[model samples]
Target: MKLLMFIKELTMLIKSLRGLCLCLESGSGDKLSNCTKQHIQKLLKANMMGPYGSEWAVEEKVKRREMVAPQARYIFVYWNANEMMDNAFTPLLGFLHFRFTLEEEIPVLYLYELQLDSSVQGKGLGKFLMQLVELIAQENRMGAVVLTVQKSNSLAMKFYISKLRYVVSSISPSRVDPLVGVEKNYEILCKTFDHEAKAILEVYSVQYRTARRVGFMAAFSDLKFED
Candidate 1:
């Protein structure tokens, strides 16, 4: 996607904020500077390590690889310098890593990460960013906005489900087969835009025994994107 197009639309949406001054920039992961990449890595680890726990060692490696993959696209958020109380305060507020990809033969926007600085949490920025993503998905003709959330991260779960109204995808382990879902640690969530998307992503009716083997393997396969 073109950065100019994103900035133009984002400028209009950001006007809804009461008093915050923000700037949005877009780039591919390979184009980010080392300093910026390090900051993102640190922020991601800080927000996710706890939920990942023993799986972090392996997950971190996967995340690191995914972070700089050529397909990875980023939207970097910065506090407008003029809005800062202290000139020395870091302008980098947060970032969203995502990709325009295919899921189950449907084009979709897959959100890989959304990390915000603690100082900015509870503000409306996170929701605003998600709204922006949904708009982008629509503009790109995507069927839905999909993401993976750790079930253990209650706050994240609440934010996506309760606040954003994203539902557990039909292919998610829990819905496909609760017995097999017990072995998984995360849920795939989605907000579909069309009837086809809703049907594919929000409806499920498979036998438990059959789902235990087929659904379990399909749901957990590396063929799908991860958080």
Candidate 2:
């Protein structure tokens, strides 16, 4: 429970920092768009907007979507060290998943990657993190959580459906959801945020970790804008 408490604090911190940073950068500066825009602009500032676009361009789009993702409003979750866990705690990419928030009033979690430090696999830590997602979403009043899985990955599919009670709903275009994985799916599941979602995601740590590593993130929501 100590770890859970730390997670809650961290989530609050992430929300605050992201909101603050956006406030500072929102609606200001010259209009640059798309990841490719910034790239081409360095070569020639004018045509780049119509053509290759810039790094800020792509980032802007991804940022906007975080709030207006057609079918869902998303919030990312991450974790960091806590009272119980020591600084030596193992982490993968400082967090997990690069999915989206379903664009809905109630919201749904669409998890992408499940990258864990190889040291923790098969130990149910993934399940724990997932449950953590559910808990955070519920805490934030989300409806359900959804994720896509590879059709070939029976092992993973089984883990989710059997262990987590997720059911296969639909397969994608024989290709993976760009954010999810190699398999095709639109499988959905529901967890009782009030019941099982007792934990919170450490979004603060998640955001900091992301910012520290990538220096650019449009993950939680899309950051695109029009000129």
Per-model CA lDDT versus the true structure: 0.87, 0.42
In terms of TM-score, which candidate is strongest? 1
Instruction: Give, for candidate 2, the lowest lDDT window spanning 10 residues.
Output: 20-29
Model 2 ranges with Cα > 4 A deviation: 1-94, 98-100, 103-106, 170-227
Q: Which stretches of candidate 1 lie over 4 Å from their true place?
A: 1-12, 85-87, 207-227
For model 1, how does the per-residue alpha-carbon lDDT over 78-174 read when each residue is reduced to its tens digit? Answer: 8886677877765578999999998767799999999998877887889889999998898888999999999899999999999999999987899
Best by lDDT: 1
Question: Candidate 2: what lDDT?
Answer: 0.42
TM-score of 2: 0.39
Clashes of each: 0, 35
Cα-based TM-score, every candidate: 0.84, 0.39
